[model samples]
Target: MRLIDADKALEKISKMIDYCEKDTSVNGLTALFQVGDAIMDCKTVDAGLVKRGKWKFTGTDKNGDVYQCSNCELKIGLDYETNYCPNCGAKMDLEEPE
Candidate 1:
C-alpha cells in the first residue's frame, strides 16, 4: 500500500491544466480534465491520510468497504461509500454495499 505524494500530485495537476488551456483538440482537453480531476482527488485523500494517521488509511471499517484511489493506488479504510476516489478523484467502480 503506497502512499500518495500530495505535493507532487498537485504540481502535476497544475501543469496539466496549463497544457489543457493551450490545447485545441477537444479529445486532448477532455483527457487532461480527467487527469486533473484524479490529481485533485488524490490531494484530498492525502490530506485526510496525513491528518488522520496511517492506520486510518489502511484499516477497514465494520461495513468492510475499503476506500482506494484507483489512479494512485492509495487504499484506506472508509466507513461509507463514495462516488470518487478521495486520493485521485477517479470515479469509484466498486460495488455498492448492501
Candidate 2:
C-alpha cells in the first residue's frame, strides 16, 4: 500500500477548475461545473484521508474506480482511505484495476 499526497490531489483539482474556466460552451461548462463542484466538495470533505491508511486493491469496478480496502477503523465509502474491519486486521477484498 502506498500513500497519496494531498498537495498533488489538490493540484489536480485546481487544474480541473482551470479547464472549466476556459470552457466556452454552456453545455460543456455546465457539465464541467457540475463535476467540478462535486469534486471540490468531496475534496473538502475528504481532505483528511491522506492521514489514514490505504490499501490498493487489485481490481476495478465498471466505473474504472481503483478498488481499495481501507483500514482506517471506520466505515468504507467513496473517497475513503480508511476502512477497518473490527473482526480482525483482515479487510474487505479489492479487485485490481485492469
Candidate 3:
C-alpha cells in the first residue's frame, strides 16, 4: 500500500529495463531492476479487485490501536446483512494515502 501513481511506477520500471539493457558495468543492477519491477507487480495485484468495488479494510490505527472488523470480508466474511463498514472503515480497499 505505498500509494504511488501506477502509471508513473510503470514508466519508471520501463526506463529501468532500458537502462539495465544499456549498462554493463553494474552487476547489482539486476537485483535493483527486479525490485523495481516487483513494486509495479504489487501495485497491480489488488487493483482489479479495487476496480470491481470490493474494499479491504485495515483493523488498526497509527497509534497502534487494534480492532476486529466483525463485518469485514477480512473478518466475518462477506454478508449483505451488515450495516457497518468492515475493518473499522479505515479504507483498506482505498489507495494508500499520498
Candidate 4:
C-alpha cells in the first residue's frame, strides 16, 4: 500500500476533481472523478485516525524505501510486512519525501 499525507492527498484530490470537471470526454472524466473521490475518502479517514491518536503521520525516504514512525521513530523497511508500528501501536501512514 502506498501512504501519503492526509492534507496533501486531499489537496491533490481536489485538483483532480477540478481537472475532471474541466474534461470534456465522458469516460476519462468519469474514471478520474471516481478515483479522486475514493482518494479523498481515504485521506479523510486517515485524518480522522490521526486525530483520534490511532495513527501517526510519518515520512518515507526519497526512494520510498524506509518508514519511520513519528511517535516512536521505529524504522520500517518492508512495505507489506506490517501495518502498525511495533513500538507504539501507532498506525503507519507514511508520506513519501517531496
List CA RMSD, all candidates: 14.9, 15.7, 13.4, 14.4
Off by more than 4 A, model 3: 28-98
Per-structure clash totals for the candidates: 6, 8, 1, 0
lDDT of 3 by residue, 34-67 (tens): 7566576644333332221234434445554343
Which residues of candidate 2, in runs, are more than 4 Å off?
A: 1-3, 26-98
Which of candidates 1 and 2 reaches a greater lDDT? 1
Error of 4 at 23 (Å): 0.8
- Minimal lDDT window, size 10, model 4: 47-56
| Pairs in clash, predicted candidate 4 | none
Writing each residue's lDDT as its tens digit, candidate 4 over 1-98 gives 55656777667767766866787565775766777666756643332344111233255666565655666766766454366667777655555558
Sort by lDDT, best first.
Answer: 1, 4, 2, 3
Compose the digit string of candidate 1's lDDT tens values, residues 8-27.
Answer: 78777777777767875647
Candidate achieving higher TM-score, 1 or 2: 1
lDDT of 2: 0.51
TM-scores for candidates 1 onward, in order? 0.30, 0.25, 0.31, 0.28
Please give, for residues 68-91, the per-residue lDDT of candidate 2 as tens digits: 445543333244433544424544
Measured with C-alpha atoms, the lDDT of residue 81 in candidate 4 is 37
lDDT (Cα, 0-100) at 97 in candidate 3: 46
